[model samples]
Target: MTKTKIAATSDVSADKVLKSSANGQSVLVAKVGDQYCAIANKCPHLGLPLAKGKYENGVITCPFHGSKFELCSGKNVEWVESFAGIPLPGAAKKLMAMGKTPTDVASFTVTQEGEDLFIEA
Candidate 1:
């Protein structure tokens, strides 16, 4: 595994997420409590950049399709629950998903060295 420096601890607070690149792929680094979690910056549903999404309680919500993913485990919390900004029903959500299965986002292990954060990629 390659350890890549992503950001500084002082730059990311408990409520914020920082976007960085590691192994030539965009990654979103979030601080949850005192732990730092790294997740793929792309949304599973539409491949949209997750950095523009909302991060709350360790979950990131996709801005385009409203898909939610857990930061630490890369688990899919909610999948395709909405479109654009409108809430979709069960049938509508399924249709909007376009046959794409609910998938977990890719997560990486983050290590802190002094004031810098690193990810194993």
Candidate 2:
């Protein structure tokens, strides 16, 4: 495993997700409550960056397809429920998903020592 320095403690907040990289792998780190969590910046559904996605209560919603993921655990909460900020009906949502199944985003180990945060990639 490679330990990579991603950000300072002050660089992340509960309301924000910081986009960084570890060993050339794009990563998104967020401060949830008192812990720092790291996950792949790319959304599994469409391979889009999650930096601009909406984050709240440890969940990050994809800005493109409205897929919601648990930031800390990388769990897929909801998949392809909407398009471009507009809600989709059941049939439309499934159609828009294009037969893609729910997949969890990759999570990394985040170590915070004092003011520096490192990710294991």
Candidate 3:
């Protein structure tokens, strides 16, 4: 695995979101409390950039199709709720029918060295 530094620790704030470039790809980084999380920038639904999406309470919702993901695990938040009989949209239903997995969204490992943040490719 290759690690690339993307930003400074001070660049990110608590409960704030930011986007950076590493390993020739865009990455979404969020600082929640004292922890930092990094994930692939693109949403799997329509290839919309997750860095451009809205982040709240550890959840990142896709702006295009509203496909939500857990920032920490890079897992689809909708799936967990849907399995409990939560009402999902028609588009999401179709995506599930098409066998779209949460793993479709790429994710990376994050590390902080001093004041700099690094992401693994």
Candidate 4:
């Protein structure tokens, strides 16, 4: 495992996901209270960047397909909730899920030394 220093503690504020890289892998780091969590930046559904998604209470929702994921555990809370918050019709949602399946996002370990945060990639 390669430990890469991504950002300072101050750079990642409470409830804000900071986009960074670890050994050429795109990563998103966030501070949930005193714990730091790192996860893949791309949404597994369609590879949409989770950095552009909405985050709340450790849950990040993909902006494109409305897939929600838990940052700390990299679990998929919901797959394809809606399209840009516009409730997708039943048939439409079913059609959209034709080729996609629910999958967990990749999570990484985070280490902190002084004010710097590092991610293991």
Model 4 is weakest, by summed lDDT over 10 consecutive residues, at: 90-99
Pairs of colliding residues, candidate 2? none
Report the lDDT of model 2 for residue 78: 94
Quality of model 4 by C-alpha lDDT = 0.87
Which is superior by lDDT, 2 or 4? 2
Worst 10 residues of 3 by lDDT: 78-87
Steric overlap count per candidate: 0, 0, 0, 0
Superposition-based RMSD of candidate 2 using all C-alpha atoms, in angstroms:
1.0
lDDT of 1 by residue, 1-93 (tens): 789999998888778678899989899988888788999999888788989888899998999999999888889999998887689999999
Model 4 TM-score is 0.92
> Number of clashing pairs, model 4?
0
The C-alpha stretches of model 1 lying farther than 4 A from their native spots are none
lDDT of 3 at 94: 70
Stretches of candidate 2 above 4 Å error?
A: none
Measured against the true structure, the TM-scores of the candidates, in listed sequence, are 0.95, 0.95, 0.77, 0.92
lDDT of 4 at 120: 76
- The reply for model 3, stretches above 4 Å from the true place, is 79-104
lDDT digits (tens) for residues 64-110 of candidate 4 = 88888888889999888788878787788877766788999999878
> What tens-digit string does per-residue lDDT give for candidate 3 at 26-115?
888877667777888887765768665567997887765566787766878753123223546767667543565544467666789899
